[model samples]
Target: MLCYEELREAVDNGYIIGDTLNVVRKNGKVFDYALPGEPVRPWEIVTVESLIDIMTELSNYQ
Candidate 1:
């Protein structure tokens, strides 16, 4: 799995090429993500702590 920094860099560098991106959420927070054409269930399996971490990182960016 890609960490937040790597994911950001990949997106910034246009490395994540796709037509569909799925962002799974749980309790109004990001729970998981799937790339284009990747199958993903619409339920939360595990809590993703990175959502909060990424939010903090983004706030810092602002």
Candidate 2:
């Protein structure tokens, strides 16, 4: 799993491109996430569950 710091590092290094994720917030907490190319509004109710898959995918590029 990718911890907060690791994910931040990835973003800072440009390993994860911009607009790759769409995050929605309610009351200062994450409510949902949209993958690349998904809608930006009418928020889809979904959970990220885990970042293991994303981390694995990003690893291939590294």
Expressed as tens digits, the lDDT of each residue in 10-31 for candidate 2 is 6688755653444444554444
- Backbone clash pairs in model 1 (N, Cα, C under 3 Å; residues 3+ apart or in different chains), count: 0
Model 1 score (lDDT): 0.51
Worst 10 residues of 1 by lDDT: 42-51
Superposed Cα deviation of residue 58, candidate 1 (Å): 5.6
Quote model 1's TM-score. Answer: 0.40
**Shift of residue 33 alpha carbon in model 2, Å:** 0.3
lDDT of each: 0.51, 0.51
> For every model shown, what is its TM-score relative to the native structure?
0.40, 0.32
